[model samples]
Target: MSFSTNQARIRCTQLAPRIGDGPGNLAQIETELASAASDGIDLLVLPELATSGYSLTPSEARDAALPADSPVFARWQAILGEHTSAVIGFCEHGGEDPSGVLIYNSAVILTPGSAPTIYRKLHLWDTEKSIFTPGSDVPPVVDTPFGKLGTVICYDLEFPEMPRSLALRGADVIAVPTNWPYISRPENEHAPEVVHAMAAARASGVAIACCDRSGEERGTVWTEGTTVVGTDGWVTGEMAASGRYDAAVELAGDRRRISPRNDVFGDRRPEFYEL
Candidate 1:
C-alpha cells in the first residue's frame, strides 16, 4: 500500500455528531467513508469524538465511551474490506488505572483488513480535562502502503511538540481529529487554529489533515476547521466557515528544504536551544 509519491488523495470531514446517538453517528460516518472512497480519496480523516460526541460530563462520558475492543472495530473492518484507510475518533472507556487517569478521547486508525491502532489525546481541552485523561503514550507512526501516517486528537495540535515529534518519528502526514470552539482573537479573523496548524506543519515539515466537527453543541459553536496543509507548510484546501466536506491533498517528499543550503529538518539546532 505504498503512497502515490507526488500525489496522495486525502479528505477531511466535519459533522454534527449528536450526543448519545451512537447508531446515527456511525451511520453518518459510514456514508462519508463510502463517498470518500468513491471520490478517489485514499485516506479519510474524521473529527474527534465522532462516536460518542463531545461535551459530556464524567459519568455521561463514561457511559457513552466504548472500550478499546468495542464492536465498532468490526464495523470499520467491514467498511475497509478491500481498500482505503480511515482515522475515526471516539470516546474510549479506558477503564481503571490506579496509577493514572482513565477515560480517554481517542483516535482509531484503520487500514484495510487490519486491526485499528488507537491514539489517545495528550492535551485535554476545557471541559475535557474534567472528563478524560491525557494520553501518556506517543502516537504511533503507522506504515501503510501509501505513507507513514500518524493521528492526534483535537487540542493536541495546539502543542507544537505533538506534530513535531510525530514528524521526527517518520510520519509523513498527521491527521488531526478536532472539535474546535470559537475564540476572540486579535481581529475576529478566521480560525486561529488554522494559523497554529500552518506553523505546526511548517515546523514539522509534514502534511496535516485537520477534521473539525461543526454545528453548535450545547450552545458552543464549533470553529468549522476542515483543512489540509501541504508538505510545504501551506494551507492547500478550504477551511469552510459553514462545514463543507471533501478536500483533496497531495503529499510529496519527506524533507522540507527552503533552498540548497537550508533544510527545515536539517537546519534544526535543537542542541543549542534550552528547553
Candidate 2:
C-alpha cells in the first residue's frame, strides 16, 4: 500500500468476554471489523490470546490452537483484507516435534495484499512459561496495507528493549495484544503496564496501539484502559471500558525528519548504560 505524507489513521478495539469461545469470539470480531470499516479506519488491533482467552492450562492451550489451514483463520484474513489491515492474537499449535512443545502464544498479521505473517511471543508470563516456549527469532517490520508494522504480546511490552528494538529496526507502528489485569493498586498508582507502554512510545518515536482484554475471566479481572499513544507522549486515542469499541488516529510515518532538539533516538548514548 502506498503511504502519503498525509495522516495515517488507526482504529483500536477493546474487546470483552468470549474468552475461549472461538466461534462466538469470531462473531464479535467480525461485527467490530465491519463497524470499524464503516468508520474508514486504516488499521484495527485486537486483544491478546483473544481466540482462547488467558490462563489456560498447557494442555488446554494446545487443544485450543488452530491450524494455519483452518477456515476460521482464512475467514479472518479475508475479512481483514476487505476492511483494514489487522493484528489479532491467538494461542497457536506449533510444529509437532514430539520432543518439543506443542503450542505457542502468537499474534498474526493480515493485510489485503499479503500473506499473513505470524509473530510468536518471545517472552512469557509466569503461568505461561509452563506451556509455550519462547519465540526463537524476531519478526521483521512488516509492510502492510497501512504501513510498516510490528507486533508484541502481553508481557513483551513490559520490557523497554522490545519496542525500542523494533523502532530502531524500522517499525513505524507497534501493535500490542495484551491481557492486562486491573488489580487494585494504591489510589494514585498507575498500572505498571500502562506506564511501560508510555515510556516505550516516548523512547522509540513509534506509534503504539495496544488492545487489552476486558472483563473477568477465570477469577481475574482485566484492566480497562485500551489505548493508542503517539510518539509525542500523548494519548491520541483511548477506550476506557470493556466490550467491543473502536478508536482511530492518524499515525506518523518513518519519513519524519531527524532533528537534534526533540529527537529521542539521536540523543541516546549506549556506551554509558552498561552496568
Candidate 3:
C-alpha cells in the first residue's frame, strides 16, 4: 500500500539504559513515549536493547528477556497517539531454536490499535554472536499512518543488502535501533557507522533513522550517533541538547527516480549480478 502521507516527523531518542534494569528502562521508555505522543511525533525510534541495556552477561540477558507478547507492549500502545508509532529494541525471550529458550536481539513496532510487529535481528554483531541467535526470517516492512516502516537492529544496517531489500520491498523509512560502541575516528569525520547509513540511504533513496545509545556502558563508550538521513543521502537531523534527533522527512513514493533517465529500482539488473 502507498503511504498515507508524504511527510513524516521522525525522532530518534538517544537514551542511556542501565544494564539489567528492566523496570527502570521500561519507565524511561514510557516517559519518552508519552512525550512523543504529546509532541505528535509520527515515528519515534529508540536505541537497541532499550529495555535491558547492552553489555549483559548471558545470565543477565536471560533475566532481562521479554516475550513478544509481553504486556509492556500493550502499555506502550496505550501511550501512542492515533497517528504516532514507535520502534524500540528489546531482548526477546522466545525463539525457534530447538536447543533451548534462546534470546534474540529484536525490535518491535508499536502502533495504536494494532498488534505489535516484531523483527528479530538477522545479523548479530561481535559479542552479540554469543548472546543472540541470528534470525532466519527477513526483516519486515510494516504499514503505518506515516509511511511504510521497516526495521533493523545495530549491525544489520552495515550490510548493504539489508536496506536494499527493504527498499525493494517498498519501505519508505528504515528505523534502525542501534548501540554503537565508540570507535575513534578523525576529529571532523562522522562516525564510520553513520557514514554507512548515509551511503545506504543514498543508494536506496530511502530515509534512514538510526537511534544510537548514549553514555558509557560496562566501560565501553558509546558513539551516541543518533542520526536521521533524508532520501537524498545527507544528514537531516542533529542530536539536540536533550539527546533527541528530530527531522521532518519525505516518505518514499511509487517511483525511485533520481534523474530524468535513471531510477534507483527500475534500473536494477539483479539477474545479472550474484548477490
Best by lDDT: 3
Question: Which order, best to worst by TM-score?
Answer: 3, 1, 2
Whichever of 1 and 3 has more TM-score, that candidate is: 3
Stretches > 4 Å off in candidate 3: 1-4, 95-98, 252-255
**Taking the tens digit of each residue's C-alpha lDDT, what string does model 1 give over 78-153?**
7655667889898898878774438889989988756788999988887787888888898888876578898888
Q: List candidate 2 segments past 4 Å from native.
A: 1-5, 17-20, 240-250, 253-262, 271-275
Error of 3 at 253 (Å): 2.4
Candidate 1, lDDT over the whole model: 0.80
Q: Which one wins by lDDT: 1 or 2?
A: 1
lDDT of 2 by residue, 118-229 (tens): 8889988887888887788786578865568889988899878899889888777899989887767778866778778777877777778888887788888888667777
Window of ten residues with lowest summed lDDT in model 1: 239-248
Model 3 TM-score? 0.95
* Candidate 3 whole-model C-alpha lDDT, 0 to 1: 0.90
Q: What is candidate 3's lDDT per residue for 14-51, written digit by digit as tens?
A: 99999867889999999999999988889999999999
The positional error of residue 249 in candidate 2, measured at the CA in angstroms, is: 3.7
Error of 2 at 117 (Å): 0.5
The whole-model lDDT of each prediction reads 0.80, 0.75, 0.90
Q: Is candidate 2 or candidate 3 better by TM-score?
A: 3
